[model samples]
Target: MTTFLLFSFLQLAQPSAIQFTNQDLQLESNSGYIQLDWTAVEGSQYILQRSMQPDFTNSHTIYQGPDHASFVSGLDNGTYYYRVGDDEGHWSDTLTLKVEHQSMPLALTLFGLGFVVFAFTVFVVIKGVYTTSQS
Candidate 1:
């Protein structure tokens, strides 16, 4: 049947491998997320896996879809490994991700300093306005 032949042709178009566009990534100290992208094949489904080990023995499947990109977020500070593959078991080179968030105390200190500056600015602005109205 025509439908059977079309399916056979699509199967024959299976790509030999999948390649991620990015090299190993290191997130900024305050960033917790990034977007992952890879080359895609039409009519083919891809799988993205993440692991703590280079061998991917304890890997987790993070995405399975036909899209070429996925958004990854909310990761704690650590190192991670990732790989992409098609339904035909063709996998690309492994990519590494390193996440290091800013320390809580340092972040709080910066926030407090900003608040102080803002309060001072507001006070100065109000005092200027009051003096100008009285003049």
Candidate 2:
């Protein structure tokens, strides 16, 4: 009798009208920042939260807004988990974002190549000098 009553109550409850979808997580340029976004929920305000660990041992609220976009800055260079909740108590599935502090620019790549060549030349010169001294 109790089980039937519980089932009937569950059926009577209405689901959340505000639905979240199309969650996207991405990095912001070369900075160690992450951006969490999702499909706009109708008639609701978005609440964004982030966590450093998979289990969400430490969670932080990043944003609360009705806008379609949100940006989170000063993130670590690793993976982060985020979730969105609407004002109507509808929460979304967690999204994962990856942030990279250093992106290899063309100029930086060329500079690195130049430094490698210079280092090799210096090493070769030192080796030659040592060999001559030994002889």
Q: What is the lDDT of every predicted structure here? A: 0.86, 0.71
Q: TM-scores for all candidates?
A: 0.78, 0.52
Candidate 2 local accuracy as lDDT? 0.71
What's the true lDDT of residue 49 in model 2? Answer: 76
Off by over 4 Å in 1: 1-14, 25-30
What are the per-residue Cα lDDT tens digits for candidate 1 across 33-107? 878899887888999999999899989999999999999999889888888998878898888888888999999
Q: Model 2, range 1-135, lDDT digits (tens) per residue?
A: 999999889875865433334434443345765445577845668888788886667888778888756767777677887777787667766677776666558769989999999999999999999999999
In candidate 2, position 59 carries an lDDT of 86
Q: Which stretches of candidate 2 lie over 4 Å from their true place?
A: 1-30, 103-135
Q: Per-candidate RMSD vs. true structure? A: 5.2, 12.0
